[model samples]
Target: RRDTGVWDGRLGWGRLTHGRAADVLKNPAYAGAYAFGRAASSRKVRPDGTVVACVNRRPRDQWTVLIPDHHEGYVSWQQYLQIEAKLAANRTSTGARPPREGPPLCQGVIYCGSCGFPMSTGYRRADGTADYVCNRARSDAVTTPGCHSIAAAAVDAQVTRLLLAALTPEQVHLALAAADDLHHRHHRSHRGAELAVERARYEADRAERTFTQVEPENRLVARSLERRWEEKLAALAQAEAALADLAAARPVLPEPDRLHALAQDLPRLWDAPTTGAKDRKRLLRTLIADVTVRHVDHSRAHIGIRWHTGATDEVVCDRRTNRNPTQAVELVRSLLDTRSDAEIAGHLNALGLRTGKCRPFTVASIRHIRQQHAIGSKRNDPTGPGEITVPQAARILGVHEAAIYPWLRNGEMPARQDRHRRWCITWNPQTEDYWHNRVATSSHLKRTNPNYETGQAV
Candidate 1:
C-alpha cells in the first residue's frame, strides 16, 4: 500500500473492502515477486462417501515456482514479509498476541503456571485494572474447573522493578551516548544547510556582478544575463529558507549534568507520563521471554521469569490484603489504647502494611478501620497515683510539653499513653533527675520558663 497510486473519485472506482485488502497483502506480485502453485485443488471423501473438491492455499516454501524482484512493486519483499509476520502475530489463534495498547505489561507473554496455557487479560470495571486469567476448563474439556487468576498490578509492578534493575547505569550511559551521537548528526545536517546557503549566496553575487558589467547597448545579451541573475537570486532565497527551517527544527539537547542525573535516576524516565504501556512492554520483551505466574495462597504468589538469555528467576510476592483483614483489624484494636490514630498508622507503614485497598495507611484510614470494626477510641481514664500527664512532666523538667514529644517517640524517655491518648510519665525523683540532665545537655531542647529552677522544678 505504501507505493500504490492513490484512488480518486474521478476514476469511478469502488472503495476497498477487507477481503480485497487481505488478497492484495497475500499476493506475492505486489511485492515484486512471481510465484506459482499458490493453491492446490484436491478431492476429499465425506463421511457419506461423496467426493468433494477442495482448494487449499499453499505455504510460500511449498510453491512450485517462485522468483524475487520480478518487477516494480508497491513494497519491497522484505517489507512484505514483515507485514505478513505482523498480521500473523495479531491473530489470537496463533498463541502469540502482539503487544497491545493496554496497560498490562505482560499481556502477550504471561502464562498460567498450573496448566501451562496462555493467559487472557480482563479488566475490572470497579478499579479499571487488568487481570490475568486462565479459563482452563473452558479451553480444554479435560482440565479442572479451577484455574489461576491474578491481578496485573502486583505482577506488573514486580516485573517493572525487575526490568528497571536489569537496566543498569551502564545501559543508561550507553543510551546517553546514542543521544549525543544523534545530536551530532543533527548538527552536521544543520551545518550542511548553512553551507548550501553560503554557496548559493556566492553564486548570486557572481551573477549580479556579471549582469552589471554587461553593456547596456547589447540589449539581447543583457536580458539573458538579467534572467540568469534572477534565477540565481531565487536559488539563494530557497537555500536561505531551508537553512532557517533547519535551525528552527533543531532540538535542544539536555545539559551534561542533567544527562548524568537521568542515568542515575532512570526509573523517573520510565515512570514519566509520556512513557506508555506499549513502550514498557517492548522494553520488557527485549529481555524477558515469558512470565509464568501461580498463586500460592490468598496473600502470596510465585512468579517465574524466563529471560531471553536463557537465565531464569523466581520470586515470591505478597498479594494485596483485603480492606480490613481480621489480622490487621485485631492489630489495630490492640494498639488503640496505647497509641493514637497517627501513631498506629505510622507503625503499620513501618511494618510494610497496606490497607485493604492496597494503599498505605494514613491517620484517616486507620480511624476509618477502627470505626468500621466498632473499636472504641481512647478514653479519658484516670492515671495511677505516681504517674503524671505530659504537661506535668514538662513542668517538672522545666521545658515546653512540645519538647518532650520527640523523646517519647524515640523511646529516649520511658512513658506510656493513658486511655485518653495522652502521655503519662511516672514522677519519681530519679526520673526527674534524668529528664532534668537530658534537657540541660540537649542543645535542641529550649527551657522557656525563666523563673523555674533546673533541678526537678520542686
Candidate 2:
C-alpha cells in the first residue's frame, strides 16, 4: 500500500509518496521512483507509498527521496542526449551545417596567370558542363590575349584529381608537419617584429612629447611642435591599430586532430554546399598561397599550386582558363593616364572589357570610373573641375529657380532683368573661377593669398 500527496516545499513544487518497503525499494521500483524524482526536478510529481517514501524537492532544484529507514538521497537521469539529437536534427533541417573549407572556383576565384584577375565561369552546355572564361576572349577576342574558354567540369575534375594526389598519406603528413613548423615560426617572428616596432614607436613618441614639453613659449614654435605631436600620435595610433589587426588576422595553427580531419574530409569539400565550399576555400587560402593557371590550348590548361607552408608542391591540373575583365581594365588604367570616359570605354571595348553583368561598357560606366578616380566632371574634389547647371543647383539646394530672384535682387549674384518683370540669375565667371582656384591651392597658397580681393579673380 502507498499514499501520495503534493508537497509545496521551500525548494519548489514537489511530489511526496509513501509505499511498502519491498515494493518501493525494489530495483525496478527504485528505477521508476528515481526517474519520477528526476522528472520532478523540472516538474511536479506525487507518489503513493508506505514503508519507503519519496519526496521531490520544490523548484526542481534537486530530486530528493525520503526512506522510512531514515535515509534521504538525490537522483538524476540523463536527458541532454535526446535534446542534443533534436537540436542537431533541427539544424540540419534548417541548412545550418558548418561552412565549407574552400572558395568557389567561379568568377571570383579563378584568376588569370598572365593578367592576375578573376576568370568568369559559365556553362558551355545545358548539361551543366561549365567553362572558365576570360572577359577579353568573350568581349574583345581580337585584341585581348588568351581569350580561350575552358570547360568547368573538366577543370574541376582535374583539380580534384590533383588535390587527391596531394592528399596521399605521406604527402598529407609532410604537409601537416610543415604547416605546424611554419605556423610556429611565423607566429614567433611576427610577434617579435610587432613588439619591436611598437617599442620603437613608443620610445619615439615619448621623446617627442618630452621635447615638446621643454620647448620655448614662442607661438610659431609651439604650433609647429603641437602639429608634430599630433602627427606622431596619429602615426602611433595607426601603427598600433595595424599591429592589432595583424595579430587578429593571424590564423591559429590547426591541431593534429583538426588537420587530420580536414585531410580526411578534403574530397567532400568539393561536393559541399556554397557556404561550405567558401569555408574550405578560406582554409585553402590559409594553407596554400597561390594558384596559377595557364592555358595550353582551347581544351587543355595547366594549374600550379603554391603552398604557403614553405613547401613548393606544384601540382598541375588540366582545365580551361580565361582572363578577368576587371583585371584587364586595371592593367590598362595602370598603363595610361588622363584617359577620357569615351577613350577608356573605347579602349576596354577594343581590349575586350565587359561588365560583370555581361554587358558592354557604356559611357556611364566610363564616367563611373572617372568618378571613382575623382577625375574630370565626374570628380568629387571640392575644388576639382566640374560643371554646375542652374537646374541641378536648384534641385540640389532644394529651391525653385524663381526663388533665385532674391539673390539677384540683393546683387548677391549677378543677374539681368528679363523682358517680363522677372530676373534671370547668373554666376560671376571670374569669381567662380577664382573660388575654384582658391580651393585647388595648397595650405601655402592660403598663407600667401590671404585676401580674395572682392571683385578680382585668382
Candidate 3:
C-alpha cells in the first residue's frame, strides 16, 4: 500500500476485484502520467548454481524516467496514486471471498494440462505481464509453488495467428462485402446532419424574404421581421456549425477497394496497434472454444486448441525462460542494413545458420523474420547494380509505395514499363534529389486532401 504513497495508513476496504477499475489504474488516461512503470527487479545468483530475481516496489522517487502532463487526464496524478493505494490495501482483506472475473482474453476457457483445473490470472508487477498461474498447491494449503505459470501473451498471440490464418478466401471475400456495405451504410447515414442544415436554410431564406417584402414605414412590423431574421441567421449558423462538427468527428472508413486489399493482409491487421486485446480475444473465442496447455521441459509448451467446429490444432511453442534473442536478432538486423532479403537468406543458408531447426532459407521466410524483428529494408542501397523498382524507390525515398505510384501514374516522374508491365525506376542523382526535397502541398484528389506530406502532387 505504501509503494506509490497512495496508502491512507488504514486497511478497511475489501479486496478490489481485477475488473474495469484495475484496467483503468493500468491506463495512463486514469493516471496523470501517460506511461507505465510501478516496480523494478534485479537478478541474484545463488551458490547452488541457480538464478533468481528479487522484485521490489519502486517508490515514484526512484523512477528514473517520467513525463508529466503528457496527455489529457481523467484524474489528477495524486488522485490516481490514492486510488492505487486504496486498491492495494484491499489485498489483505481477511475472509472467504467470491471468485473475481479473470482476464478478458482467457476467462473460463483455459485449463491446466496437469491438474485439469482452470488457471487463475494475475498481473506480474515486475514486468507488467498478464500471467496465468495454476495455484493448486497453494489452494491445497501446501508450501510448494503452483504447478504452472505462463504469460497469457504468447498463448493469446499464437491463437490469434491461427484464427486469422484460417480465414479462407471465400470468408475473406464475404468480410470485404460486409465492410463495403457498412461503408455505404455509414456514409448514407449522414441524412440527419444534412436534414438539420436543410431545415435551417429554409427558415433563414423565408425570414429574409418576409423582411424584404415588409414596408419600411411600418416600423413595428419592420423591426419585428428584422429581429426574426437575425434569430434565423443565428440558428442557421448554429446548424451549419453542428454539421461541420459532425463531419469532423465522423470516422474515416476505408473504401471497398482498400477493405478488399486489407482482407488479404491478415498479418498487417493482426500486427496493427489499434487492434484491441478484447477484440482479438473475441475473434479467437468465436473460432476456438477452448485451449489446453501442457508444458514440456523448460522452453517448450504443447498447445492443443479445440475449434468450435469440432476440429483441433496442435502447436508447439518455444517460450524462452530467459528469452534473450538479442544477439541473434541483432545479427539479422545488421545484415538488413546492407543485404536484400534474398541475399541475407542466402548468406545465412551458406553459413549453416537456420532459424531454430534446419529449415531452408527463402525470401518469403526472411521477410517474415524481418517483419517479426522490425528490420528495415536495404533497398535504398541499390542491390546488385541494376535498375530499381517502385518499391526500391520507396525505400530510398523513405516513403511508401503509394507515394511512388502517383509519380509513375502521372507523367511527372520518368518510369519504364517492362514487358512484365512492372514499373522499373532508374536511379538518377537528379530524381533522387528532387524526391528527397519534395513534400506534397497541393490537393491531388478532387474532394479530399493530398495523400502525401506537404500536400504537393507526386
User: What are the clash counts of all predictions, listed in order?
Assistant: 2, 30, 8
In the range 389-436, model 1's lDDT, one tens digit per residue, is 876777677788788898889988777875435687767888888777
- Compute each candidate's TM-score over C-alphas: 0.52, 0.33, 0.31
Better of 2 and 3 by lDDT: 3
Q: Worst lDDT window (10 residues) for model 2?
A: 69-78
Q: What residue runs in model 3 are displaced by over 4 Å at the alpha carbon?
A: 1-104, 142-146, 168-262, 326-458
Worst 10 residues of 3 by lDDT: 95-104
> How would you order the candidates by lDDT, starting with the best?
1, 3, 2
Better model by lDDT, 1 or 2?
1
lDDT of 2 by residue, 199-263 (tens): 75886677587666765857787777767777777777776777776676676666777777777
How well is each residue in 1-458 modelled by candidate 3, as lDDT tens digits?
22335576654455567685577675545655755455688999999979999988676676656676777788887687677676664454642122243343664567788877777777867655676778776898764332677777767667767787777456767756766786676666566778988999999999999999998899999999999999999998998888887676665655656655766786677668887765555666667878887888666777788998798999988654334234445666887755666777787777766663346667776776768767765544333344678766765665667877788889777767642245777667877888767744333422223344344675
Name the candidate that leads on TM-score: 1
Q: What is the C-alpha RMSD of each candidate to the true structure, in Å?
A: 23.8, 31.1, 33.0
Model 3 / residue 379 / CA error / Å: 42
Q: What's the CA error at residue 146 for candidate 3, in Å?
A: 9.1
